[model samples]
Target chain A: MAEVNNVVEALKFMALGMGVVFLFLYILVVLVKVQAALIAKYFPENTPKIPTTPVGNTVEDENRRVAAIIAAVSEFRKNKS
Target chain B: MKLKQIFISLLFAMIALTSMSQATGQDATAPVVAEVSTEKKAYEPKTIAELATSFWQTTGINAIFDVNDGETTSEPKGHAYEREMTWFESSLGRIMMILIVFLLFYLAIAKNFEPLLLIPIAFGGLLANIPLAGMGGEHGMLGIIYNMGIANEFFPLLIFMGVGAMTDFGPLLANPKTALLGGAAQFGIFGSLVGAVMIGFDLQSASAISIIGGADGPTSIFIANRLAPDMLGAIAVAAYSYMALVPVIQPPIMRALTSKAERVIVMKTTRQVHRLEKLIFPIVVLVLSILVLPESTPLIGAFAFGNFAKESGVVDRLSDTMQNALINIVTIFLGLGVGSKLAADKFLVLETMGIMIIGLIAFSAGTAAGVIMAKIMNRFSKEPINPLIGAAGVSAVPMSARVVSKVGSEEKPGNVLLMHAMGPNVAGVIGSAVAAGVLLSIFK
Candidate 1:
């Protein structure tokens, strides 16, 4: 009788435990979504916008930089034993 | 006058030495021992041979050979602790425990298995088995450590604070639905509890033992110390060992549960969380927990405080200290404190075997549940959720999260589920704490 009671009680405990966890986290999930929406509405971030378009000289400068890196690598490789 | 003064000083010093020598006899003045004949029924050893014999009595080697602790009849003797003579309390048992400690050392050092904790715990076990050392006895060094933080449940709570301070809830907040996986994983705890109960352990011991499935060490220790302190040693060892072996234990189970197609599914990257949202999260969690279950406050409160401190940005110093210095210091004591419980009489029992076997069952069940939960979520949701990430819901923290990512990558090269998995991993921490709270409220 006691062993049966033990199993039954354990099942009840398991249900309560699993139920509470799911309830708590599920609420948090909804709350999180709500919190996200509310924050988006009120406390919007001041994101500094970057200029997407490259300047005219950047392409030529990039070429020069790549050439300099190549020259430096060749020089270092040539110096190596 | 100078010679008279010097003679007087010498006479005073001689008198003091004679009295001191009578008590300790280290000074070896034979006349004092003879003069105090009536007082000295227990004569101090005078000869070198006698001294050696007395010294041997105090040594570990002699303690091993002594039958004073009543090894036979399973008789309760000498503070109700003794070697079983056949099992772990025997001299052979002590040596075996030492060798086991050596294996722990090898695992920690060579195999890189949770070295920060295992090293201290292994060392404490070493100190414990050293006969006559009494390292695990009342007022002994390890005993003091055990009583100081572990016994009162301070160390695990403080560790929770450190874990909280370091936790980033951004991923969890980004994809909140994954929290269900965390909750589902806790089935491991409940499932194991039932198994333990069925196997003749009482409710409290079963509850404490089952908590190891949560795969959160501090939470396991907190619950075990509270519910079933007698089983603390075995439960803790099982908790830590399985946690360290997360990679080894979790992967095969994960593979068995999920199809290759499910493993290869890619998850959406998490959205950026606002600083305000981050700051409010811990507060919301704390308030909700306090309202619902006051029992979980010790674990959750510390965790919430840690997360709040980190999010506040104003309390960087406090947060940094909690994360680094405070946590490091607590880890050392906590490791030793847990290790103090690894005394042979406590650890090498039938219950330890029971705890280990059931602990594995709990852990496997949790992993399978998490994966299955993820599959269920996929059926209901528009976005494809990789079932592999569900296995991380046991909250071994970054370890289980990393395992998910590794497993996912195995299915599809360059696949990343780490951030996605973190959602459930973090939730598992909360989920386990909630389960712990429920258990405490009922069984405590």
Candidate 2:
């Protein structure tokens, strides 16, 4: 029984190639996960993320803020004049 | 219409074709032939008719029409064909080849398909087909550059280096599970290998052609040069052309394989990757590649060096060079070197057709395989994974990633998958390198 040598060889390449690619990448996944863990544990960033600024809770505060903005603009304009 | 009526334009075209390559093929081409007339000293033309006749005989039209002209060792400018072609074969082949070059230019310009490489390659091909020029022959300029870079395997490795230098592996480092999608996409290469063998190509050529599934032009050229140098032109053209068409080819396969719900699935971004982790990444990959598959070391080593230079932060100048100037220069030479193989004898064969068809099938199969693999992963995955991102695993780089993102968002508004697709996109690059190594280990 003479099987075509090309087919046999091609089948070998397919199996080995797919197997190696999967195996290599699989190991890489594990390594990257481990490396991420090691890095997070050993050397973390110094400053934590900044929190969003909290807004004041009343209408009086909003009015005062607007008046301050207008006063600052007018005072700057008077100084320039 | 042509059978009954005399076509004036067709007759003129035929007449035009003959006059182009015959100028140096006959008459005054050889000293002995000119001296055959013993009556006149030095064979001088006494009459104007005699002078015109001699001049006309030297025209390309005469050479093309002369079917059984006596053998000459060298072409008009001393370029000899290694495979002795007849006057008709040589001249006719060049004519057909110039037409093919025009189509390549059209694809690059009008169609906007891979213009950067295609323009240079088409120009090289245009020069290669000039009658009796032998610009693509061994001693010619294009041929010398071809030997210096492509033949020795440095050009592809250098390209991989540029790719690595520019690639951001943070997305891949953040999500390791997506690496499986990259590995799964390589099934297209192996699967295409079987199909190519069945289609009557030898094992070496089949392997070279199948690498087109990787969708990375440099790797395809590298393997083609190694395993099947004769088919390099066809494989490179097919690989680059199909890659440009990825945005067109991938979506249909991806849609067919995945359900709407799977496509719409939203994935959560992984935690931030540390700078140290990023720095060590290329070294780990390089070391591992050498340990497991030394055959892949050249590709992987160059890629790692480029990434390391970028990550080191101190060598911004070197990194800048690798990613820009060096890569651009290599690309021009690489394109022309590949185009040198577009000589009519190599390109006009039936095998080129087989390579184009196989390349298309391989690309589609790779996209489908990646999608299927992602669907499987979603079943086991605790976090919801969108199957669309898996289609980016064929290593078309940012192109496939962008397409995946576009396709994913088309299903569900505001469902961004570009960053997520990048994880598998980069993984596919490494996966294909490993696959190429395996193929080399088996054959070499």
Go through the candidates in order and give each one's DockQ: 0.27, 0.27
Candidate 2 runs further than 4 Å off: A1-5, A46-81, B1-81, B86-92
| Residue B444 lDDT (model 1) | 54
- Runs off by more than 4 Å, candidate 1: A46-81, B1-48, B69-90
Q: Candidate 1 clashing pairs?
A: B83-B89
Provide the lDDT at B90 for model 2: 59
Reference-based lDDT, residue B376, model 2:
94
Residue A54 error, candidate 2, Å: 23
lDDT of 1 by residue, A1-81 (tens): 898899988998898999999999988888888988898888777322222332247585455344434533443343221
**Model 1: per-residue Cα lDDT over B1-444, one tens digit each:** 999977865554455445445546554544322221225476554664434444444545545755354333111123465334443475666777789899999989999988888998888888877775667765678888887888889999999998898888877887889989999999999999999999988888899999998998999999998898878877887888889999999999999988888887766545556778889999989988998899999999999999899889899889889988999999998888777767666677789889999999999999999999999999899888999889989988878988998888788775667778888999999999999999999975
lDDT per residue for candidate 2 within B257-331, as digits (tens), equals 988888888676444567788799999999899899999999889989998888888998898898889989999
Worst 10 residues of 1 chain A by lDDT: A46-55
lDDT of 2 by residue, A2-81 (tens): 23777877888888888899999999999998988887777767323322222355564455345434533453353222
